[model samples]
Target: MKRRFTVSVILSRCSLASSWIFYSEYFYNYQNEGRVEWVYGDGFAHNLNNVNNLVSSLRFVGDEDNWKMDSITLFEFDLFFGIEYYDWTDNTQVPSGMSTVGSLIITGQNYWTVYTSTNFSGNRACLQVQSGQYVGFAADLDEYGIFTVRSYRRGCFGDKKITLNSDQHGFAVKARE
Candidate 1:
């Protein structure tokens, strides 16, 4: 006999998060370059005309930054599902045989930048790392724009350290500014 699996079982194995983007068919041009036809979020995609696979460029228009601190994990499917690519170091391009990026997982105390095209060209989004303690699970790239990730660079803000010390009055204080 052979063991069988279900979609729910497979989903349960990996953690899930809320947030997604409506990918377009062209590069970022103030939404004028292409039409927004693919909506992916919360672990599923509303694919139309197979536009989800044709996303080429994206630009984050908002000022929001900061993401969960963890090792980078790129998913081939929305909502942090499918073909997971985990890495701690930066890369100029996606892994061999992997092309599209549906989601991201940023780790550690350093912010990372994910680009739409290779060599950090084309559209880009800077995922800032949360300050203080690291949260195990983080929100997926929420509305960061719609473009597949091709290359990524770590240490967006470099390594930040916070030191605690006791002052003369025995009161805990942050060491540096």
Candidate 2:
């Protein structure tokens, strides 16, 4: 039997312009990170039904040219195999005048949700999944105070285990198969 796993991210209270830029930068950075590939919208949609080890990154890159600020929410989802893996990070800091409130990671049987707030101070939160649950972990923030979450599977392949970081800027989670 094949199992599907999905990961999603949602950002609340951000301007459309910023959202676009943020997402663009996110995809750019993800490609730079070299851990995953940039799968466009069509590629993502087409692969959702298959059980494979795939990583999809979606960002709400806000419009930087517009001086106007608009509250925005960003959400993304990924689906793969139960024993598959996916990971991401928002290394870039919000624009100077922008604020990030908070972030949340909700893990389910076949899907996970990550939510980020607009207020800068409030946007510093991380969620890690271990044994099919969100494991509160530590995070390490850069000079810009951008929060990130890193997760992977450990143990003997099928008997994998998860480890999570217990910090505000960075988080890690391990899961066992």
Candidate 3:
């Protein structure tokens, strides 16, 4: 039997017009820092499905524009909610001017609703039961600061992820065989 592994991320920094969210792709027990070819344009939010490439280290690149981290402490990610913060030990959170989007991870048997825009608006999806994965929309992603995850039941992925080939960014939930 096959199992579906999925993961998602946001910029986390508010004002960063562009940024890079890195993930360590893995398979079985082997993994690497970041080998995934990122377009890195306006950035991207992806829900990876079952595949050979699994993201392990989900990190937000804050210094792309060469902005010095003067005294602004990284934004504190909500302990239990949309923000995954995978293996982020050193410094967790971005400066005030920067805020990346976050994914609402679900587990067990609770319903989860995620909005492309905050307050639940513009292109939305939900997971009720079984194994369901929601891939965020690219167009709706421009809202910024609005896609904050609202979950009644969820948790962050420990060390596993699956992604799709995103060009226009579509959604598909595959069943294990």
Candidate 4:
């Protein structure tokens, strides 16, 4: 892990009301290490057993300085199927002892607030995705790197048909239209 993952977000237009960035890769840590920790990288929580801890969340509360009332969305993914890695830089990350994700989390907030488990009956892992991205299931976790998803959680966004996947079996929450 000699490479440094220096991530800095520069909003083309500083407006937080209707804009967001998807979580695909892990952001730099407080120590500014180039290593990847599984807190909230690749739109999924870091390795559940040992994840890249999430320090704080930044929300766009309809203003430039949203610290007053900014709300953060905390999403978690239980990796019971297997450990996976999501690389959005070029979508071609060859990890050592890691499997490729069939789907990716584009962007959104409050995703886990709707979905929780892979299926209603099973609790193999807890599911968490972005609110704005439409996600479905990944047929083969070891094959495709990214794929389009469909909604699985009920009562999400009130069937608003908003745009957003994986067994790699997990649940998803579709955002509002």
Candidates by TM-score, descending order:
1, 3, 4, 2
Q: Regarding lDDT, does 1 or 2 come out ahead?
A: 1
Residue 24, candidate 1: Cα error in Å is: 29
Candidate 4 lDDT, 71-144, residue by residue in tens = 22211222112233332121111333432223333222333212222222211122333343323232232233
For each candidate in turn, give its C-alpha RMSD to the true structure in angstroms.
Answer: 16.2, 18.7, 17.3, 15.6
lDDT of 3 by residue, 12-110 (tens): 211122222333343211221123322222323444432215444433322323211111112122111122322112222222233443332222233
Off by over 4 Å in 1: 1-70, 135-142, 157-177
Candidate 1: give the clashing pairs. Answer: 70-106, 70-107, 70-108, 71-107
**Model 2 RMSD in angstroms:** 18.7
Clashes (N, CA, C under 3 Å) per candidate: 4, 52, 21, 17
Clash tally for model 3: 21
Question: lDDT of all the models against the reference?
Answer: 0.42, 0.24, 0.27, 0.25
lDDT of 1 by residue, 43-145 (tens): 4322234233444432211112322324566766444333557776788999976666665555445566777788877666666534552322222344456
- Candidate 3 least-lDDT 10 residues: 67-76
Candidate 3 segments whose C-alpha is farther than 4 A from its true place:
1-98, 102-104, 129-177
lDDT, model 1: 0.42
Tens digits of per-residue lDDT, candidate 2, 1-177, equal 321222232332121111111122234232222121112111122222111232233332212232112112221211111111112322223333223222222222122222233222233322233443222221222322434222211112221222333111221222222
Ordered by lDDT, highest first, the candidates read 1, 3, 4, 2
